[model samples]
Target: MTFDLIIALATACVAFVLSKRSVAHFPLWRAVVTPLASIIGSGFLLLGPILNIGYGGYAPLIMIALCFVAFLFGGVIRFNMAAGEQAIQNGDYGALAIRIETLSSWALAFAYIISVSYYLNLLGAFALSLTPFNSDLDAKLLTTGVFFIIVFVGWSRGFKSLEKMEYVSVSLKLAIIAGLLIGLMAHFGHRALDDALIFNPPKLDGWSALTLAFGLLITVQGFETSRYLGSEYDAQTRIKSMRLAQWLSTAIYLVYILLISYVFRPDQMSSSETGIINMMQIVAPILPFLLVAAALASQFSAAVADTSGSGGLFAQLSRNRITERQAYLLLAVIGVALTWSANIYAIVNYASRGFAIYYGLQAALGAVIAARQNTGWQRVGFYGLLATLGAVIALFGQPVE
Candidate 1:
């Protein structure tokens, strides 16, 4: 799992740097890159096991279909950045921010609060998973202390530091996961393959596949971070990075799902929070420990990236006059209020819904751009947006419920 993402992420970084081009417009590359940090955490761990088991047999076919959905997600990254820039060019950044808040509503704030808390839990899970070569309460307390320490450091560090931190943590998690998977495969050998090939396929047909696709949609839905990074890059670079990284991530995820499916019975996988770790346990119990370590790395990197990006966005929004320091202060107060009361499961579920809506909003922007013929690949983009909206609505349902 660690090394599994290396090839794709390393490629994304290269593409990110290379995509830079001179343009007098809003920066998007950073925003696009930052979204990756958000997606690679809890969602990645939970999404595959649950969606695959619930909707389809552990088959490569669904993985392939899911890749298309992720591609549409990438289009969303492009749409958000493009639209935000257009709003600025029209001298309406404040209006754009209003539109954003209007679209996201209270659910957006609630979802983020849940996300922050869950990430903290993930940080605790990471340390606990690694705690036994065995220690006791002191060790646990120390780990808890470390989690708070990371949050402070992440919030305080500037963008350069945050990006570097994410790259390192992301790299470490990928390495650890890759090693564990390889180690497990070697130990398990080929015996499981014959049984896996015997394949008790899913019985569902037609529209159910679409619903499954929607569920799978949650897994591979990062790649919007580059848009956040746009201020640091040129326009051509932003667009290219957004497009290439999304497609690349889709391809990588498809391969991962396929290989993992081939290795085990998808139905045998648990849907509990520890599902990914449990799936690895089936391969090798020790793999769970390694995954937990990776999970720690996952949350650390993602939180740093997300918080920093959000802060920058505020600065951008304020610089553009959408909100003031009071808005920022109020948001912080709201976050603290929601903190201790958050239920991990419900928050994560609500987060997925919020993400779907956010992505759906971006898709709407893509459709508008497509209709106007403003960018390369507009027609595909138009359809991509629709597919994403369909998936979001069809799979996760509405936040109002």
Candidate 2:
């Protein structure tokens, strides 16, 4: 009870600070919040158990590798924000660059469709997890309902009202997350003093491990949200905000994984989607409640953000031939189909591949623009390699078994 009180107080304090006028009104913080919210969204809830179960003691190392790869891809997006935007505005870009950027935008739209399904499905799972009706079919039905709700609200009243929920949801999620970290740290320290920490060996080796890591890219995939905010923010602000968001999320993820990796034996971890909830039950009685709240807020906010983004991209790409309402309807239809057709793990893999293809195209576009500007071959070559890596992830990333 004392620990729970401490956790609750910490969470409340963080929430209060984040809600302050000074912090909320800061321009860079506002810019940082959008991408930061997306980057840490549903992924934070899922990664702990998945990483520990899959990689065992090596989970923290794998987390670092994922963050590093995401950082590199973020660099590619940042480069395009500065160079690609200017070139397109001045007609300084070539036909191929234009085509690649267009294709990448399409890829991103499709990825958003899959990701919305992913987010809502997780939301449904978590929503039901603490109840008596926590079954797979029940979860999917709930997800389908939420999809309809989002589409209805979006088509009827517009997302203007719903969009206002982003700030509150993000603040709540971050506060709960800070509390989670505190609980995990205290648990970890207790085990350390007792010499109870376990360092289990990796469960899968070499090729299988590599493919699994690739499949998990969607966990770190949301930083590119900054690249597409060109309409709202200037290039420099978007670039800097993206870098800051990535850095903040990376730090959060690494610490969470490190504290979590050695705290439990491999045999105790659950492989189910809501495994983190059960794992946190062992950390603190209050943690499961806090985690579920964070999961719901983060997932709904992320789904709404991506749905809004996908609809706008569809309308923009169609040159306004397709209205945003029509796009929302289409996204709802596709998202419902995805919710019924495959499990969450399969959706995660599909989303990862979709984003990888988009990243690959963006990297290729970056390389082309660099070459056109007579930039050194070394920079172009690095972008080419990054493009190839993205392609590899798209082609080879596999679903968790």
Candidate 3:
């Protein structure tokens, strides 16, 4: 009860602070991904699975690479905000978000399609974890439900519904995660740190390390969420939130990876979609129950939030004429279709490939624009190119078995 109270109060405080510093949709001190379930759903949960299978035990190396991914993400966010402002000043914000309208039209297609895939991943994982019914059946129902909800909410209430849901879900997720951390530390004691150090990775040299790290960069691409925050924040407020969110996300990533890597045996970690829950079980027998119950809320909130968000983005592409109801229907229809794949890893790998391609193009496009408009744009383009190359490696370099 005491711990729960502390968690609640702390989350409330963070939300309050974020709300105060917010402009447009950007909140001070809050990670933008927090608003949508995808941050943890896509990036955090997949970390263990991707590392265990793809990179083996060299996740720390990937995480180090992710730091740069984080920075590039920051720059992307800044660019969008700056671009939007520039457009607005020029009285051209009607298509400001579509700054490169034709190019962005394609970009939006790629992003929203990838987002649909991501939405299914979240919903599928949830069904795999909870309920006694068949995941296929459950997934279809959930997907359909999500689509209707998004359309209903989006048209009726607008993007604000997403921010509002984020306010609730993010607060809950942080509380639950903090509790998990405290539980792990309390039970394992400081000796767990020893586990992190025991796994010494083989040296691949600096250049090779960078190359391999670049391949893994796609895994950490979730932090630039602020870019979608146009009309939600002023430049000053957005920049502050952008930097803080990335650093905070990094900190969370480090603590979580260290926790899992140190506390559980390497072999015990399964590629089960709910692998995090499995890891918690090793920490304490009762943990799975606690975690499952907690994760239940986290998952549902996350699923609904993500489903709604993807719908919203698509609606934007349709020039709001597609209507929120239509977007929700679209999301549901897609999720039902994706639920056909029973294999989680295959779905995830494909989704990663898709997202990498999407971000790759966005960075490339952003870079081209920057080059013509700003000499510094070349660096952004190049960085994205390297990251895209790395993503290609993740797909092509390894057998992906």
- lDDT winner among the candidates? 2
Q: Which portions of model 2 show Cα errors greater than 4 Å?
A: 84-86
Tens digit per residue, CA lDDT, model 3, 1-401: 55444544554554465445353244464445443344454456556544544444566556656766656645654665565545633545344324544444344444444454545555555545645763656655665565555556656776667656656655566555665666555545655545443453333545554444444443455444555555566666666666666666677777766655544455667655667666766665555555554454455455555455455556666678876567666655665465564344444444455545545545554554555465684575575574475346445422123
Native-vs-model 1 lDDT?
Answer: 0.54
Superposition error at 71 for model 2 (Å):
0.7
- Model 3 worst lDDT window (10 residues): 392-401
- In the order shown, the candidates' Cα RMSDs to the true structure are 7.1, 1.2, 5.4
**Deviation (Å) of 172 in candidate 2:** 0.8
Error of 1 at 248 (Å): 4.1
Q: What is the number of backbone collisions in each predicted candidate, taken in the order shown? A: 34, 0, 9
Model 2 TM-score?
A: 0.98
Local accuracy by lDDT, each model: 0.54, 0.89, 0.53
Q: After superposition, how far is residue 311 of candidate 2 from its true place, in Å?
A: 1.4
Which parts of model 3 have CA positions greater than 4 angstroms off? 1-37, 53-56, 85-101, 116-124, 127-152, 187-219, 297-309, 373-400
List the pairs of residues colliding in candidate 2: none
Error of 3 at 87 (Å): 3.2
**Tens digits of per-residue lDDT for model 1, 118-192:** 565556544554456333343335434544564455446556776767765665655554565455455345656
